[model samples]
Target: MQDQNSAVTLADAFNQATYIIGGHGSRKVKVLQEALEQVDGETFSDHYGNGSIIDEFQQEMAEVLGKEAAVFFPSGTMAQQIALRIWCDRADVKRVAYHPLAHLEIHEEDGLKELHHIESILLGEANRLITLEDVKSMKQEVACLLLELPQREIGGQLPAYEELESISAYCREHGIKLHLDGARLFEITPYYEKTPAEICRLFDSVYISFYKGIGGIAGAILAGDSDMMQESRVWKRRHGGDLIGLYPYILSSRYYYNERIGKMGRYYEQAKELASLFNACHGIRTIPERPVSNMFHVHFALAASEVEPLLVHMAQEYSTAITSYLNKTGGNSCSFEMSTGDRYDLVPQDKLRDALTWLDGEMKKKRF
Candidate 1:
């Protein structure tokens, strides 16, 4: 147990908070200010649907991905559901193959099952990035296949490009439509010297989240051939994603994608350096030797439940904010996510120790 009195925040110790995970928020507020200027409309307006920022956003995304078209959906869930539903509808099949931990599977509260009326065949192992081997190994008759790049369950581990090629080749040979759940696709580019468009070309359709890596307020775009993406716009309307006005998300996404898109490399480099710091600690180990993108898991001696609140409190009290976390499973280990911000050795360890030592003193109170 961490002694309640022993932890300290960044403010108290070094006047800086340590962020270990999550996208860099608000680096360019000017971009947001630029968007808000023309955002006068209803919360989710859709009556006129004339030049909705959503359309503009989609057009920009389409160009970025080198696709014929793109459709903006309020949520990745809707975007992805539409992709699978369309694939199933086209193939006249009702099944989709995906990793068990894919967001569509584990998250979403079974929305795909209840709403899409499609069955999902979970085709990968637990806590591992599914490889081409995993894909080839599956015996499934399905309408389409979904793969989450940088598998979230495994701290953003991505399969090699060769593996991606092999899996997509197999799918192509079988006439299976491939849909990529590219929620964090930006991160994958660094691992492989490929552009987003190049990698996305493998899949028939690709869904990218505006909020995750790009740091937008919230939105998603599904990109594919002109006809497919145009058809998706219809599905988007059916699923209530065709909002009359989605200017805030549109503006934010434009700002993020334009200004913050290329920072993934910097973030990943920081994660590697931070990983070294965590590994140097007495009771810390990385979930994977190398992080696939800007994220990785750090196992600790403390329970995540206990560590999380304290980390927050310490950050608040002293100024070190721990951005992401993983509570352990069946063990005393907790996995902490460290972003590049903390990895920068700006604050000396001795100075941080004062706050941490203070936290140690304070955490003792929680024990009782």
Candidate 2:
């Protein structure tokens, strides 16, 4: 019987939840919602099935990514798979080269194999990057190359720009097309000191995610030259990504990008500050000496049992949130991905240091 407006949310109980994955959605989403509610406003009028809005978005993204054209998809998985399939069709080859931890190689559930019938040649070690020299040693003529910007599973590490340029340049000389899985690209831009369009200029096809940085409900955009994307649209439908309603995605994306853009730099700053606070702690070390962006991983030792429950209990007590994934060491490591949320606004580096220190103390107290 209560009004819908009075509904409660998960945020009402937990105040300090550190959003390692899905942070707050963007700010620009509200404006779009407001516009949609207007009396004469046409929210899905033209763009529902076949519309110019998609074309407009594609063209703008192509220009921003410095490609000839672009195609929007309901998911990055479809965008990336179709992009590779297109390359295979164009090159008349079926093999791809990529880092071992690349999303397509590990996370896409073998879509390239099942859906596209393409194979992958893992380019490097589980813990390291795939370099130009790795490409030089390839045994087969791959149809394409896949590169993930700021490789996430390995902790958001990126190869040096010089190395990235060399790898792409080598692909060009060898008649191999390069495709970029630029899902977390905007976060990587500050490190490279380059624009998204500039980073994408070297590749034949680029896929950017709307959910990761832009905070959309869910969507992805694939950009390339006109002919390629014109072809990708057909593939998009064949692959079942042509959703009937895209208003929620577009609206949320538009809003989040505008609102959260200001906070990204602060995330990077606070990550560095937090890294400093964890200095010289026992059994604790950052994956990389320095966090490349707003995201980083903390590798620490604790009793296997203490790892998960301790985090959950502390989270509940402090009204905070965090996620920890187990490791080969039988210990636990946690990640901090500072995206969106006022939860972290009042949480200082010292507080995080205190938490880490508490975890260590708890482990010792239990004699584990």
Candidate 3:
């Protein structure tokens, strides 16, 4: 149990720590200044997501994702739901196939079903990546398939490149549309050794989140052929996603994408290095053994109660914040996810290894 006196916020823990599992550190003033500097004379957009930075950003994203057009949404939830709805409507089949843990199925609170009237058929086991065999096994008629690259819920697992191609081929042969839930698309390209466009080519529509790997203030892009995106714009307005002015989020997304997009390969390498360090420790291990992307899970042999205090203590003493808390998966094991980015980049490898060693020792001592 954590003492009231020792309580630390996740935000403060992030700021105090020289390293973190996800994202770079930013001061409020610095973030504000960066956003302001990125903007030119014109700041705001005209009515309903038009004529300014929003259109410019959307155009840039469309090019980046290799699509004829792109539409911006305030959230990925709105963007993705609309994308799936489009596919189902086109095929006249109200079902989509995706992993059981895909965001659309678990995280969206049934919005796809209740709001869009689309049914989801979950694919594959909870602990495994979706395979071509699993796709072949689904007997239901699905209008589209949604693939979440790097499968964030299960320690950022991803399908093999050849296997991904096979699954997409199967979808195409069957006349089913493919939509990619590429919220962290930028982070996964390093593993596949492919460009975002190359991977995106396999899908009918791709949705990218601005805030996740790109570190935007907040926004999402749904990109596809012009006809599909044109229809999406209407859905965006209907869903209340078309804002009067979205330049702040657009400008922030543009600035961060430019700054961080080039570094994702390095982040993927760092994740491998960090995972190796964790696996080398006696009492800790990284899930998937080798990281396929910029994220992985660190499992400790300690209970949740025991691990929480250690995290709090680490924050107070070593100025290292591993995570805010640990989740007990089952039995005596607890796991927390680590995502390498600029925060981890700021700290030396030797220093981070030392922190891992100390954490290992604490977990061992507590277990005995």
Candidate No. with top lDDT: 3
Tens-place lDDT per residue, model 2, 255-275, is: 556566566666566656655
**Cα TM-score of candidate 2:** 0.84
User: Candidate 3 on 1-368: residue-level lDDT in tens?
Assistant: 23444567544665677556555765365774677784666555646877856777888998889998998889999999999998999889999989999998788899998999898898888888889988899899999989999899898988888998998999999998889999999999989999999999998899999777777778899999999999998999998888887776777788889999999999999889888988887668888789999898988876676667677666656666777657888777799888888887777666666676777777667764
Q: Given candidate 1, what's the lDDT at residue 250?
A: 70
Error of 1 at 113 (Å): 0.9
Candidate 1 C-alpha lDDT tens digits along 1-368: 33354454322432345532334543466646765665564535334234754566677788777788887778999999999998999899999999878898878999999998999988878777777777777687898989888787777778878888999999999888899999988877887878889998898999999777677778888899888877887887888877766666777787768766777787778677656655655555676667767777767666666656666566655555444345675455577554443234454555455555654554445442
TM-score of each: 0.82, 0.84, 0.93
The candidate 2 region of ten consecutive residues with least summed lDDT is 1-10
Candidate ranking under TM-score, highest first, comes to 3, 2, 1
Question: Clashes per prediction?
Answer: 36, 5, 1
lDDT of each: 0.72, 0.69, 0.83
TM-score of candidate 3 versus the correct structure, residues matched by position? 0.93
Better of 1 and 2 by lDDT: 1
Error of 3 at 235 (Å): 0.8
TM-score, candidate 1, is 0.82
Candidates arranged by lDDT, highest first? 3, 1, 2
For every candidate in turn, the CA RMSD to the true structure comes to 5.1, 6.1, 2.4
**Residue ranges of candidate 1 with Cα displaced over 4 Å:** 1-22, 26-52, 305-318, 323-326, 338-368
